[model samples]
Structure formats: structure tokens, C-alpha cells
Target: MKKVKHTVKLLGALVSSVVILSACGNAEGIYDDKGQVFRKVITQDMSSLDTAKVTDNVSFDKFNQVYEGLYTAGKSDKVEPGVATGEPEVTNGGKTWTIHLRKNAKWSNGDPVTAHDFEFAWKRVLDPNTAAEYAYIMYDLKNAEAVNMGKKDVNTLGVKALDDYTLRFELTKPIPYYKEMLAFGTFLPQNEKIVKKYGERYGTSEDKSVYNGPFKVKDWAVEDKIILVKNNEYWDKQAVKLDKVNYKVLKDSQAGASLYDTESVDDTTITSEQVEKYKDDVALKKRIMPATFYLKLNQGQVPELKNQHMRLALAQAINKEDYVNSVLNNGSAVTDGFTAKGTADAPNGKDFTSQIKSPLKYDVKKAKENYEKAKKELGKDKFTMTLNTDDTPSSKISAEFIKSQIETTLPGITIKIKQFPFKQRIAREQSENYEISLSGWAPDYPDPMTFLKIMTTGNTSNNTGWGNKKYDELLKKANGELLQNAEARNQTLIEAEELLLNEAPVAPIYQKGEAHLTNPQVKGLHYHNMGGDTSLKYTYIDKSIDRKTGKKKTK
Candidate 1:
């Protein structure tokens, strides 16, 4: 790893060449001598800026910059105040949550942001017409499910705007993890006027949405390039030093590496081959992200997958270690539980995986036996199934590897592979149209419940149609009684996870690992443990000072 020379003129010229600079001037104060331009490449274009409808990591990352939630997770994975003044006041055993907003907060449009904005956002998200994939996240709110199901009127929902600066939320249960859930983008505020004006076009393009966070999106052409400019009207604009952030969508890893090599892009992720070429580069950094890649078994569509023995056998047959090492080559580790490895501690200060039985042992003999039983039960000569995946290179490779392993392990089973565009694949998976779909989960908050409770009987994310009364009971206890008592809560969550593992509803594959190639000239950039986009609110590129200090240290 070698340090490179930093030059403001050269970097500024490079960034300006890629994006149109609407209003340009010299950086002020500490950044007067340092340039304000930075560049990076995104793997996919953001599908929508509507926080409620976003489901994928790309959309989550982009929307995070444009919206500000009541609370946000800091680098330490602890809940921190964002739009709120401080910790919310909880009364009536968590049924009532009162939040006080910061007076200085304002939308990018110069409209004073109020607590009513959040009320509008939450109601819209839970509305049945919205069809938000993450709508289940708000089920804890009183009457939310009923409202979403059209059983109750929207006005009956529990959130109310108390004047312009205060908001109160009423929940159906005593949810201890409620505060953390507020940090999710789904809890961010939205402007009712803007949404109505754009109608269906809202959040589909850069001009269709409003921003209240530290940055504003610009020039967002799908599959092309997107840009983020510092929001001058942001409440914390003083801390946002980077004037502009540029993101180019490069689907090809080799092309991304070339862009980094040619200095066309300031930062990019490397593939396995590129790792060997640039592992020694000073800019290379790796992180273990809080995400789990898994194979979703569509029990509603595939009768064979409905057999617990067959699902367990399929889980044992696929080799996760091989996929992590051969395919990812990025530092991803094998996942045995739904919760990510490095996520926050459970109530008992114990690892979440320790509480669950490991479902990831390799057993070819058992797989064959289960397949035989499945064939007999189905009254068919052969057991055949199709695995659906996205068109990404990594997904294709993973799908092929799984296909080969299943074909080799199960003598009479024939596996077909189908790959579609990322968006189309999401639609298919949502419709329960595939026998097995490759999908992943990145936690919206730090709680273990965030992972385990999302697949209950009628959860919106329960695409598998998996329902167990006992499992649901455990989840209910964990969410209600256990949350109030920390020790009890941890034990209950562990028990619930074990139940899910035994049922084999979803096959755990590998936790994700992220690698980025940052420019030596870029400073103050950090990756969030949760799989949201990079936060550039406090990030800046200083060329006049040492890269390590970003300023002249005084004796």
C-alpha cells in the first residue's frame, strides 16, 4: 500500500468533467483549500427514493441520504438522535411514545419540516394501496395491521402530530426495540404535497422527491450515473463538507476496476481476481456487513419444498463455505442463523447464533434419502425443481454452484436455473412464483426480532407462506413480555430462532462482506455495519493537509 500525492485542482477537474456543477465556488472555512468533489461507483441504480417502497440495499443506501429518520444508528451501532432532540419519552408501558423534533430541521425545499410529515409518511406506508414490501415493519403500531388490511380507517392509526414540533405514537404492545425501529428509513418523514403532485411518478426520479437529510440527489439516470450535492438548508449542513458526491453505475467488476485504475472513479469494490491485483493497495478496505444471503423456499408454489425433510436435506447439501471462499472471495463468513454475525448483542450478552441449533452441516446421504422420500410422496418418477436468481454475475455463479451440488448429491433430482433482471427477480419472488429464490436480508435495526419476527403467519416479507403457531407464540412473547425484561427477552428470541431453524423455512447461506477501493486523497469516509449506503454527512476530501490528519496539527 502506497500513499499518493493529493492535488485539489486535478481532483476538482476530474469530478467536474463527470457531473454538471450547478453552483460552484471555493470551499469555505476548513475546506477552503481542500476540494469538495468525490467520486464512487454503485453496482445498481436506485429503483426509488420513496422510503416506504424501497426493499433492496441499493435503494436503501440511496434513500438514506435523502431522508432523515427520527433516530439513526451511529458507527457504534447504537441508536442516536437524528431529527429528534433526544431519546423519545415512553409512557404507558411503551404504548405511547412522545418525540420532540429539532426546531432547526427543514426540508430541502425550504419548507419547515414538522412532526406531521412523519404522520403522513407512516399512514401512507401502511395504507393497503401503497403495497410497500416493508409495511409489516409498522405492525407494532396500534391498529396498523387493521388499517393496512382495510379493516380499520386510516385515521384510526395511532400516530398523531401534536402541533408542528411534537409527535406521539401509540403501539399495540410494549415493544422495547421500538426506538431502534425508528432508525429505519421506513420511519422517515415524507411531504404530502410533493407526493400528491408527482402521483405515481413520485420517488421514481431525482426530481420527483424532496430531501431533508444532509445531501440532495441530482442527475439520477437509471443504469447511468447519479450525483449527490450537499444540502445547504440541512439542519447539520455545517458538518457536511463534501460539496458533491458522484456515483456511476458499473455492473461489470472488471470495468469498475478499470475505472478505479484509470482514476475515473474515486472508489469501487474489487472482485476476487482484482483482489489479488490490488490487495496491497493503500486504498483497499474490507468490512463485514450485517446482511445474510439465503435461499428462499417458496412452499406455497412448490409442494416438494413443503416437506420439512426435503428442505432440511437441501440446506445440508449446499456447501456454504465453498460459496463464500470460491464465489465471494470477499471476506464473507458462513451464516448459521438469520441474524448477522456482527450485529448488536442480544439481551443476555451472548451471540445470537449460540442460541440456535446449527442447520448447516454437510450430509449427502441424508439429502439423497430425503429426495427419495419426496419423490415417493409426490408420486413422481423424478423430483425436479427450478431455482430462480438475479442476473448478477455473482448470483449466476452461486446458482450454478448450487445446481451442480444438488444434481450430484441427489441422484434422481433434476435442477433448472433461471436468471432474470434484478427488478424482475424481485417481482417474481414477491409473487411467490419460484420454487426457490435467492434472496438476502439486511436488518432495518439492531434487534434480533428484526430478523426472526418478519416471517410470521401474515408478515409482508413471509413469501414462503411458512406459519407455525408455536413459532408465532414464541415471537409474540419475545416482542411483548421478553422485551420489557431484558434477560427473558434474550432467551425467548434465541428459542424462537431455534424453532425457525428446526422448521427449515429458509436456508441460511453466507453473511455478506464488503470491500471498497478508496482513493488516497479521499478522507473521512466510513461504511455502516448495516447494509445501508455510505454516509457522507461528515465526510470530506482535504488535499492541503496530511491525509491522516486532514489538517495541520499544532504542537
Candidate 2:
């Protein structure tokens, strides 16, 4: 990682608006009522802005606006063109993808964005020294896994830039969701010169990198605020409605709602308390997010957690039904599996949740029996474990509730709650530094594999240090031999999840249901349950709202 001096400074005037691929891609036409400012509240501090290193939703949202990938996730999760010209030319039974880059796409620094940028960025994610946690997401690419494992050269990865505009990549197998995968922040392009120049410091600040998307970073103050202004050099600048995007960090959901009530922010994700307060409010939109929050036992970090009896005891001690109903007043519901409820459909046209049956439940008697067995095995009469979670109000409440439940149900067990800022909590989890951590996953794609693959033996995301050979074998078949057979693949995933849950590697808590108080005037705010939270590029404030001073806005 050494500094490079060659910055692609393509000195010229701005280009015309780039061509959008399809109608469902977005709402076409300039907005007459679009406001100059759009304000929003975030629950956590950003982790990273570099596409190769970004793993959090907040950073992913920023990455989506500042750096264009080969494709963009459009309205209703539709695959939309970003730097890509149009639909890619597929060949070799979908194993190969040949895409043409839009020549008009330019970075904020006036560099003509080229295929080479994508080639460098993808390879960088796999570079051993870079230590990218999401590199496993690209394991579908030929030689990508081997490169990340340090067994093969990164250049051997089956991706190439035929020229300035043409980019091609070969997959080890036909990925049905390849187009959707390309829309992820991990695949976003980067300027090699800027990256090499910044070295390890890339994405830490605003000036370290350049932007090629709808907006550019005007300023970024760590844990304080991030201000993004319109990227006039962007190819689709004309279509970008907001002149400025303001993201303020407010971990307290109640404070966020207060901001919304005061009209200081256009949107805020409310907590369960606020959900109850705004039960009849029209502005409070309840959505069952395509995400799951669960309890993960760190087998490597704690020896007792490796015991099936202890794990089962931990899993069965807490009542998910009560937790979701009382603790999470949001639209969340008890979940038995890690895969979300609405993510993918099974062969019988049911969601993955309805198909998997696990033995996990909140039975006080069975939980006590398992604890006795664990104590017998460990030769200990008493045990204590720490529960790690984010410092957000919602997470703190969840942890406290879980702690109280587990301690009351199991006589000799004590639970300690360790709260860290969101990003620090993620860092500690990835490093396997906690006993039992409250973890959540929002799917990167619509497929069941997006939820299932994270539990693979050596995956960077498998922070639990829980692994099963049989589980891995089923996933292997699902990804390989069953790629063509949808029914078989679906069944395989169900079986895999059942096996994993029954073993108590992790306890399925609840599927998140987000309740957000949004200004009625916010229009075309492209949002999905997965990936980034929202695309500010498409969001516009259409009109003013005179919110009631002290109560939830009913209008």
C-alpha cells in the first residue's frame, strides 16, 4: 500500500445527463417542487465510505450517493444502470457478464470513470492485506475465493477491462441474482490513484476520495454530521433533486421524533415508544423490514458457549413472543429462523420463515434442565455472560430486557450488558470479542442465500465462531448442484436453517419492523427493506409541513 501520483484529472466541462435504463428504474422528469434541502436523522455513526470497506447501512447509503456501482438499486429493488450503459450481455449460460460503461460518467475530480476503476476496486476487496470483511460477498466470482484465501493472485480473478468502456467478469457458476449483487456497495467503482494515495486512510474523511454518483461529500465530521452537496460532475445531475443532503447522528429514536415534530428534520425512524404514541398517526409508516435481529453466541470467545447444552439454555431462556410484543413495540414479530419473513418464497409459495420448524422455544422448564446439564458438564454451579449490543436506545432496551429475562429464568446465570457505539460494536463483534452479542442482518439481495451464506464456516460475517460441517454441505449443494433447481435449493435452505437453529448456534429473536415518521412532502424516496436504507438521489422534499408542536402529526 504505497502512494501513487497519477490522478485521472480529465479537465473539461460537465457532460449531459446520462441515459436511464428503464421506466421502473426511477421516476423520470425534473421535479418542480423539489426543495433545496432534505434533512434526516440516523441512529448510528458511519463506519466507512470506501466501497471496498463499507459494511454498515449508514455508510452504504453514503456510498450509494457518492460512488456509483455498475448498477444501482432502483425503486422496488429494480436493477438500475449506474455506470453501466444498459443490460449486460450475458453468455456462457450466464457465467459471463459483458457490460458497457457509460462514457459520460465522470468523477467529481473530472476523471472519466472507466472499467479499470471497477477492476481495481473488486480486486482490492479480495486483497489479503486490505482485510475487507465483505470480500466473501464476491466469492461467486471465479477465483475470487481463492484470491481472498491468498492461494491465487488477485489478477487471476475472472474480471477484466477490455478497454476504457468495456468491463467483463466470469462467474464460477450462474448467479441468478448477479444483477442485484452488482447493485451492492461492495461492487462500487473506485479511482485507483486516489485509493493508493490515501492508502489506509481512504474513506476516513471527505477529501481522501472523489465521487462519481449523484452527490459529492461536502464535509464529514466523524460522529457529528455528514453534508453532501449535488455533484455537478455527475452524469445524472439533472435528475438529482436535492441540492444538499444533511445526515445528523442521533442514536435516540425519541430525539429523532422530536426533530421531526419540530420540522428540524424531514424524516425520522421512531422507536417502539414512539410507535405506540403514533399508533393512529398517518405520518407514522410501519414497515416489516427485511432484516432480523438475533443473539449470537461467540463459541471461540467463551468456552462454555461452545457447549450445546449451554447454548440451548441461553436460547430457550428468553421469550421471543414477549420480547417482540413488549420490548419492540414496532411492527416486529417473533422469528424462529434467521432468514426474514418476507425475503424469499419457497417452492410452495410460502416465505422461508413459514417453512422452517425449529425446536427452539421459550420454555422455562426445558431451559432450566439444559442449564443444569451445562453446569454438570462445566463443573460450575454459577456462570456469568456479557451481552454485547449497540448503545442506541432501542438496542439498550433490548439488551436490558434480554438480561432480565435470562437471569430470572436461569437461577445460576447472570447476564451483563456491554454497550458500545454502533460502529465500535460491529468492530468488536467481527473480532470475536464478546460472549453473546445482539446482531442483526439486512439481506444484501432478495434470495435466501443472502441470509444463509453469512453463517458459512470461515465467512468474515460469522462472528459467532459457530460452524457445522453438515450445514456447510447443505449450503454447498444449494449454491452448486441446486442452482438450476429452485425447489431443491429452497428445501436445502430450509433444512440448513433448521439444523443450524436446533443446534443453538444462535437464537432467533425477532424480525425488525421499522416505524418511521416522515414528512408527507418527501417524494420519490426510493427505499427497500434490504441493502442501503434509502437513496437520497431520488428523494425530494415536495412541499412544506406545519407539524403540530408537541404531538405526533396526524396529517
Candidate 3:
């Protein structure tokens, strides 16, 4: 199954430790040689540049810079044409779409960016042996599911290259956001020649990948630094102003922010602990990311989590409002459902959050009552569970908060906290090595299925081993037969969420909000609440702006 933009697991857990590096030929927030060079610190290192293999937001961010798909996320989250001329022409009752690609588009290696590139990329990912974790994201394509499950041949897959510049896709159902889905990283076209040559080394380093997007990898010093230079051979090179994009993989937020203070970098996301220091600073920027930071209770590891009352008690024991306003202090939105607000909308075109009642709201009395019932059911008055989290400052704080809340509300319940590095935590989650884990997910697309599909029985992304047949059936129906009726589909999704929350396989704590410091000269560094998080394609530096005065300079 597809992993969350896992934003915008650790979207709230931003930055890990830093190896302070000198400026990359930049002066006063501007590159000395090429003023368009943009420098910033990233939360994590890019896992892979191979579009088929990536399962994290950090990789997705770099993918956005180096690849172009049928569609791309423009500034302000607007959908714009990348290789394709525009949206596809709907036919065969909206199941089949024919897209016209830009004939002039070429990869960094000078190969024509053709329809076959996309077809090859899609088929490669759906191939069962490829073992792509995000193969489910492309399940909307006809036969994509069967192909990924090893039940069908890759050639039978719905996507086809009609010619050199035109591509066609046959969907299992008519998807209204199908155009937007193509803009996703999984859908980005890959160079067939480069993949064949590089083999296992493909996209592992700067030399192994070719780009058709605005930038190409200039240098990649894994876990140290990554530098992307503008793709001169790109179809629309004029639109890309930045000559270089520099990213330093840092573990701590304060070190990054300090670099920003020294005018060595452009922007850095501040940690929760540092929020107090920059609460009133002029350069401080805050945004409530559309993401859910939640607890994934591993029923397989801890048999008690399988109990509905135990899950309910855990859900009700915490005060979400206090956690958001006090602990986070970054304008995070509180919700009881897995699907974050502004993620999807109802058939009536209203916010989905507005139409439903939150089933997991906090109530100490309910928590206590449920706790007693859980104790009786288990015939135990005392229990202990370990909570897993990353080593980031934010993750540490959140773990302590949850441990306190559960232990305080339910007496005799001992909670142990264990921390691992960011990637190590994901490894433990996949292996089911802990009782409870604090993780997060951001939408890959603007649909309920993006969030809902993870929890279905046996989805790899479903770190929690909790599954209910009814909940799975509801999602299947909503995304299947109910696609024709938006209202009915919305209702079905809502029911599924309510049912799942009653079991609390993964109880949501709060929507993630980001607090950071950005250079005044930086413009169009858009942070998306949905898929891709942020794209640097439209991000440019305005040299006319004075660094200190926050005003444009004039002759």
C-alpha cells in the first residue's frame, strides 16, 4: 500500500541533528555567483530518486524538483501542465483519458520525453517483483491492482502509449481528481535507458538519475548535502530561475535556524522547543499543515490493543485541544478522525469535517468508565505498554505528553518510552517491534481514499495490525460503485471513518502545523497541505528585496 507523504509521520517531527556546513557560495541570503541559487535545510535525507521506490516526503520533495509528470503542482497548490499540454480528454464514459504530451520535452540525457517513458515507468512500478511500497497509489489504473498482486501481466495494465507524444489511461472507475493524481510522484515518467544502465545503483546517487523537470542532481553527499542545478535541457528552462538548490540534512532545528540567522541559508523549520524564542520574530512563518499526528496501536504486538474498550479508553483519555494549544503551540488543528480537514470535501462541496461529528472527542469520565470495563474484560488492574517514537525534539515531547496523559487518566498503567532515529523508527514500525507508536500521515491526493486506504487489511502502510471486515468493505464500495454519486460516496467514507475510530486502531492527536524562519527574499516557497508537501519549481529568490528592511530596493 502507499505510504503517507508520511508529511506534511514526522511532518511535525521536522529536522533531526546538523553537521554545520559553510555557505554554498551564497552571501547575505543570495548566491554570490548566481543570485538565483536557493539554500535551505531539509528535515530528512532523500531515500531514493527512483520514483518507483520512494515512500517518504523527503524523497518526494527532491522528486518534484527533478521530474516532470503529466501534471504538476504550480505555486499556491494550483494544478498546472508539465509535460502534458493540459488535462486529458475524457472518453469511454470517463474511464479512458487521452493526454497530449509536449513534443519538445526532453530528459537531461537528451532522450525525447515520450508517452512510452510514462508507460514504462508505470508498468515497472506495478510489476510485482519491483515490490514498490507505493504501488497502491496507482491502483486506480485498470489492472494495476492485479498487476501489483501478481495476478496479471504488466502488459495488460491500462496505461498505453498511443504514439510518441500521446498517452492513454483506462481507469477502473471514473476519478474526478484523476488529473491531479497524475501530478503525483508515482505517476512521474522515468527514463528507460538510465534505469537499465544503472540497475541497482539507479537513483542512488547524483550520477545515476536523469531529469526532465526543472533541475538535475549536481551533487549528492548522502546524509550530508544535496545540490540540484537547473536542467538546461528542460522544455521550459526559462521558467526555472534558480541555478542551484542546496539542501543540508540536519537533525536539530536550532542549528538550521542559526544558519538562517547568519545569512548562510534561506529558510529552516523551527522545532517545538524553539517556538518560544521566535514567537514574535518578523521572519518567523507559521502554517497549519494538513496532516494527522496519531498513535498506531499494534494489535499484533499487544493483544490488549485488540480490545475495543481499551482502544476507546486510550482515545478519550487525552485532551487534544490542550495538546495543540500548549504542547504544539504551532496552530495545529485537532480532530478525532484519520482524514485531516481540508483534505477532502462532501458532495455538496463543503468541508468534509463540517458534515460529521467527531467520534473520538475527549471526556475524562468516558475514559475512566471505559478503562474500568477494559480492566474487567482483561481481569487485570495493572498493565504496561511501551510507546515508540523518533529521537527528534518534537517526537520526544509528544511521547512524554501521551505517556503522561494515559498514565494520569488510568491509574496503575505503566508507560515506557523508547526513542529511535527517524528511519530506525520506520523500520521498527514495519517490523511491528513495539506496542504503540507515534507516527503521522499527510494526504498524497485530495481524496478520502488517500488516508482511508492505509488501514485496509494487509496494506503495507497499515503499520497497525488492526483490521475490520466491515470497514474495508465500506471503503471498497465507496471507491467502487459509489464513485458515480459523490454524496453517497462521501457518506460511505464518513461511515467507514466513524467505524474505524470506534476501534481506534490509530487514534489521531492533532493536525500538524509548521513554524519556521524564511529569508525575506525567498518567494513562492509554497507549502502544500496535500500531496508533495512543497515544490521548488516555482520557488525563486527576489534579489531586489533588502535583507534587513523587508522592502524592495530601488535605484
TM, every model: 0.89, 0.91, 0.92
| Model 2 TM-score, all chains together | 0.91
Q: Candidate 1's residue-wise lDDT over 303-411, tens digit each?
A: 8788887787787788778877876777888887787876658656776666666755666776677667766777775678899987655566678888878778876
Q: Indicate whether candidate 1 or candidate 2 has the larger TM-score.
A: 2
The residue ranges of model 1 lying beyond 4 angstroms of the native Cα positions read: 1-34, 544-555
Task: Score each candidate by Cα lDDT.
Answer: 0.77, 0.82, 0.83
**Best by TM-score, which number?**
3
Q: By the lDDT metric, which is better: model 1 or model 3?
A: 3
Which 10-residue window in model 3 sums to the lowest lDDT? Answer: 1-10
Tens-place lDDT digits, model 3, residues 1-555:
012213313443332212233454334332233568888887678778899987777788788889999998877667889999977899999899999999899999899999999999999999998889889999989999999999999999999999999999899988888887888899999989999999888998989989999999988987778888899999999878888898877666667776776677788887655678877777788887778889888989888888888888898889898888766777687888788888887878887867666657888999899989999999888888999897765566777778889899988788899988777787788778888988888888888888889999988789788888999999999888998888788889989888888878887889888887888888877777656677887789898887655688877
True lDDT of residue 130, candidate 2: 87
The alpha-carbon deviation from the true structure for residue 77 of candidate 2, after best TM-score superposition, in angstroms, is 0.8
Give a tens-digit lDDT track for model 2, residues 1-555.
001101101100011011112111323211111357777777787787778887888788778778888899888888889899899999999899999999999999999999999999999999888899999999989999999999999999999999999999999999888899999889888999999999999988899999998999988888867888899999988898888888877666766666565456777787665687887776788778878888989999889888898888888888998888877777888877788987877778777788888777788898899989998999997888899998765676778789888889887888998999988888898888888899888988878889888998987888888889999999999999899999888889989988888888888888888788877777788887668877878777655443433233455
Clash list (residue pairs), candidate 3: 6-9, 7-11, 9-440, 16-251, 16-252, 17-251, 17-252
The candidate, 1 or 3, that scores higher on TM-score is: 3
The TM-score obtained by model 1 is: 0.89
RMSD, one per candidate, in order:
6.5, 10.8, 4.9
* Stretches of candidate 3 exceeding 4 Å from the true structure: 1-34
Q: Which is better, 1 or 2, measured by lDDT?
A: 2
